[model samples]
Target: MNSRAIKILRELLASDQPITSDYLAHILDVTSRTVRDDIKALNHSLHMHGAKIKSTRGTGYELLINDDQNFRHYLNQSLNHVSQEQALLDSPDARIRYLVKRFLLAERYLKLDDLCDEMHISKSTIQSDLRSVKKMLEKHDIYLDKKPNYGLKAIGNEVKLRFAMSEYIFDRSETGSKTIWRDQLSTIADADKEQLDKVWSVIINQIKENHISLADIAINNLYIHIAIAYKRIKSGHQVSLINQEFDEITKQKEYRVAHHIVRAAEEIFMVKFPPEEIAYIAIHLLGTKMVSQTNMSEAELENIMEKQIQIMTTKILDALEAKMHLGIRHDKELLIGLGLHLKPAINRYKYGMNVRNPMLQDIKLNYPLAFEAGIIAGIVLEQEMDVSIDENEIGYIALHIGAAIERKKMQSSPMCCYIVCASGLGSAHLIKYKLKAVFGSRIEVMGTTEYYKLKQIPFDKTDFIVSSVPINEDLPVPVIDVNAILSDKDIAKIEAFVEEDIDHVFEYIQEDLLFLNKDLQTQDEVLAFLVDQISKTTKLPDDYLKRIYEREEIAPTAYGNLIAIPHPITAQTNDTFLTICTLKKPIDWADKRVQFVCLLNVEKDSKEDLQHMYEMLGKMVDNPSLIQQLVQCKNYRDFINTLLAQN
Candidate 1:
């Protein structure tokens, strides 16, 4: 199958339910007919194997496996074919990725001639690719050391080197090229693929036997850690865990599992692992444990959630509510869920163990509001725990927050309806009972009263007024006049009042604010350019740029995927407007490279629902292909067209 077909299959494998062809087509930037043809072709190829694509009439398609053994064989063969196609890495971006893995896993200086021969490229092309590679390496504090006759070597701190290796030596993208990195690793003489497989088998067995659940990406990270450790140990290097950290880790249940796995691997590989090495594996286990959210008594669960964790969770939700107003603070499930997630997460951060969140970009795109709220939670965590939390941890926290927001949406809160009557209490009672019976759980009758008593009643608690008599008093909520015996039209009107559609947020984007193909170098330069441009039209505060800088101090605005949404610490503009700046090239913005800069100035003393704006930007940040299109736009109209097409 082709790359697009493989991507479709990978997406299908990730999902449990049937995915519609239209959605797949939109994601793949292809037509529905093309997606259908690909599905037909893929199924034809899989028929002789185990799996087949089953399509329903109205529903989409799902992959059904008939023979597991045959499917595994087919998958192995396909992966090997993908490995053999490495010689086809001709594009600049493709070559960059290959060279990154190559340099990161290289043992000694690589000669220019050998590199050219390996990639089947010219000297000038290799030189250009090297410039891009140098930029990437510089971000990780790694420098390219070149000598007259010795060629080029990567020089950096060992820890930073391993971090950089972990990033590029793996297929972190949401595609079917997961094991392709392993194939690349086999080409490295120092990396023993067979030894790494032994570690992988040990980890899987321990995870299953101990009933500890881990996502596939987390397991893959564990495998990478083992391979790194093996390589470092063979090269006479070792990672030192603090004595206190080792003590703390040994007290956990994961430590026992790590011990067993380490012993088994040592016996098989005949390599002795120090206690610190075992503790290192235990750290990965502790950070990667998926919360087993199940039914349990409150008393039993309280034992797991310490008092401090509960307080931290409370502070996180409060900050989220104050900043985003997600209206999910009181969700008991959310409170307990965040508390449970933070407990292990706190330990992970205390020991400086960074967990790779494979779905970080996807989570930010799908749940922008929740992800922003997660950022606030990270800030709160930093304050309370005295340890900085990265975006990966924040993404995991967003999952819980997003689930809570969804639960709040699914829960139908009763609309409080108060009855106003001119007649005796009997008529009011009759109307109240009828409304309750009709609306059922949807409407809560807050008690019937006379029209004169309506003034004394608390309208703040009421959503709408059901008045049988003509009440001319202006109130905060909608007043629905209905007969003592409610009519169908009256019910429809009340329904309309109760149900409100979400406001469109992208309407706030002004065409004049868009600036394309600007020559920008640094983060401050981009921010200054945007501020200077918008300051002409809008009345911004004198300390506008300083306010934005302060906000960056609190947390960097770089949200990854070559996108940065920088806003002032507080609202300064007279009106809410989004100013777009697409750079000529990617510039360093703190730790991330950014080319698409969005300066959001919220209206002063204004309360507008801006969740849609965050979601829109999140979509742009998550899709690299979309960002590439956006950054290459030469005009405002082109930018708008590209953005609207995605929607």
Candidate 2:
């Protein structure tokens, strides 16, 4: 079957309910007729495989497997290999990774025509994929050197070349290609799986015996580099480092540990590691070695980490508090954690090492407020220490800040609540005394009042109203209806609300700011559309878009689930607002496909606690089915209702 037909089958298999042809066409960027024809052909193919396309009139298509055994056998024998082969070209993100690995491992320049022939894609398709390939390479300071006859070759510093190679090849989650990197590596050179395993064992033995501390990712990185070094050294390739750098790295304790690791590898591979090669391994060790000085007094923590790192930590927190008043400035745990993290980070920056953060996306989606605070902290860290930090490092810093935020929340004042009663003053006193007895200091009772005087009640200091009688009229604060004596269910409801304090989703979404199913096809187009729509009602800074782009540079705001939450690096408006846009089709935002774009901006010079709003957006970032529902929304009421239902 053709790739499009296979894609239709795949989509149908993934969805439990039937999907309309128009929706499939929109996803595939084809006409409804083409989707129908593909489904027809797909049904034909599935007939012999014990599966058929069950089409529902006025609904859509669903894949029904009549015989699971027969279908599984057919899939294993037929479609499995075809899908793997077709996925490279059928998916742009996958194709870009394929092209990157091809160039990274190529010994000589490659031709465009040859790549097209290999992938069975048109010249235009490969050319379009090349732009993304070039952008990905440029992130690691590598450039594609093009020739008239010879198509393209990646040119960059030798160290960066190997670093990019490790990331693209060894990083299975991000860069797993059609043929595994190990299989390709065996073809490209003398490097084999067995030899790499031996190198890994040697490195682990050395690190354990020498009393050195390194995270698992760090250890894997060192292993990959050393194995690559072995292959290059065997091929008569040597690394070049500045004399000053070579001298400084050789003096560290990590350099001695690297020596043992490299010496063991040299004996097994029957190759010798040059001084520069040993130093390269040492650089990896220096960059990734974690300092464990947690749960100590401030003086003890500061004493363990360098004085310079301690000073940098103080500045980072001070600056973070200055820009965003998160109330974590005096958090000693944060101070100690930042001090410990920044020390190794300094080594990473000095030697230009990039650490991979697997949790970066989850961190951004879950702790958005903390992640934004981490951005401010990153900027402060760069200026305070005169070093550059990437998103991966920023993610690590966010974890510490997130912990501090949690601590602040726990230690902050209790939820102030007001009581309303229709029975009498005695009933209000019984309710208040019961709440205090049950909840203790967790909730503070801000006096009680009768229901008739509720019109004159001020709610500025109250979090919510606990009323024994039902109040039909909407007030500024939420009212929780309860029995006069406050039943256990009522207490549980209040307990849950107090723990989360999540506001309704409607507070963040507005009818005027919501744009559904716009025809924008690119990241820039979507952002510009949202900015234009928002600017109609609210005045925005002249460089508002520029600030958003700057945040994107730090890390793409696309948090998967076809959602991208774009916001400025710093607050841009006088009030907090979110402008949302859902596209007709998914567009490429960095590496992920995004259909729902929420442009977020916090208020400037304001003291609003925005954790609840950020948490709401975070939940949206993590939910795919919810995003689908939001994307399918045709009107503001439906969209708002869908969000409220989910909320």
Candidate 3:
């Protein structure tokens, strides 16, 4: 099977229902016939893998698994093979990626004929590919300089070129034996690889000698910067840095390691590195890791930790408490951890260094509520210190928040679920046992009883009721319907009630709060419009717009999927409400292009478990399909219907 077949298998795995071939064709930009052929070939390969594609007459194709273990092993093998395979530049998108990589790495002009011959495409096709390549490069401040006879070359600032190369050269998602940057170096010529390895060995040795520990990705990033600096200097493109900046950078211990690393590289590669190059390497070291702070005393630690960081941490905790109402604001461990982390983080921002966060996705998925709190914390710090907090830094902050949330959970009472089963005592006991096995001590099963006895039980004693049979009675608490046999799906249904929030979402969403299909171009215009509309109904703070702008400065509320959740820095409204506005076209919201803006306002000093509502919004941020459906909504009813359907 080819890459297209792999794509077909992936799509099948992602969906639970049968997906139409036409839909797959539209996604892949191919014909329905091609999709069918690919599915056929895919089924042939899956015969031994314990999974096969089943096509319905009028519906589409679905993946039927015979053996879970076999299917998983086969899928892993296939994905690994896909990762190692050579680049397929046959399609327009693939050709554009190849063109961009080539332009980024090329030392000289690349002729149109050469590119056409390389990709086996026509001049017109190559021209179209170049346009896309230019657009992508422009994001990194790199541009294509096309000459009539000399061909096209990449022209940009040296720093921007290195940043672009770091992104394009390595496969970030590689999961094989070879390290990411080393695997990327496999594409380079043997001679260039030899030269690059010399610098890599020197950096490794010097960092080891200095007792500096760096993650694999950080090491790869630093190596790429050094490798780029080496080539540029050899080609007579020395980086220029002011004496004062160089002097200040030299004061750091990383500069000492960078100086030695460069001297060794200068002898092995026989290329002199300017002082500015050493300072550049130092910046990477400073951003990537912290020197052993364990040796410092309590007084020393306090002295080293600037007063602004303490104040910032307090502000962040206050904001988290005010908005999410997560009861982890008073966690001492969180305060110290976040405070220490921010001390170095602020330094990284000051030097304009980029740090990689490998567990960002996992943090977002597993600890979504904590991650949202981290976003709030990041905004507060950004406002206080006047620094840009990227998602990477936010991930580190989320770790502290996640830990604090865990601590808070440890302190809180377990969630109580009263069982309402129509089955006999034996069946009820079996269901109770299954629930206990799945949820452990975190969930307290408050005994099981028949539907008749359910009303006799106190409603305030339990958070929710899990039932084996449907209950027609209007209960005070939410009732979760589950199966008598207690399957995984049944357990999931019960778990949904564990973090469930009150259904105040639609209540707060009035028709007046919604602005659909508006001709808004900038973020400021959207904010002003939403704030002004809300002001007409109720009094707003005089600095409401200023507060919203401040939150944007902390980090963008645009968490991708064309959604931006902009809220005030502090709670300014007495009532909790949302003002939703959808644009006619997408506008740039920080680094993300957003069409939907959700202006959130939490009630001041209100006590409520709003985490469930935040989790629902987080799901919208993670799902593009949901965002698309919400954006298509023309009225309050349609919007509410979409939200209900998704939840």
TM-scores for all candidates: the values are 0.67, 0.80, 0.66
Ranking by TM-score: 2, 1, 3
- For TM-score, the strongest prediction is 2
Per-residue lDDT tens digits for candidate 3, residues 530-639, read 99999999798899999888767655677655678888877789888888998877777765568888898888777876665676677776665666667778888898
TM-score of 2: 0.80
- Whichever of 1 and 2 has more TM-score, that candidate is 2
Give lDDT: candidate 1, residue 387: 80
lDDT of each: 0.77, 0.81, 0.76
Tens digit of per-residue lDDT, candidate 2, span 474-506:
899989888987788988778767766444545
Q: Candidate 1: where are CA atoms >4 Å away?
A: 1-92, 120-143, 157-160, 172-198, 205-216, 241-256, 289-311, 382-388, 418-461, 465-473, 480-496, 502-533, 541-599, 603-647
Candidate 1 TM-score to native: 0.67
Candidate 2 displacement at residue 349 in angstroms: 1.4
Clashing pairs in 2: none
Clashing pairs in 3: none
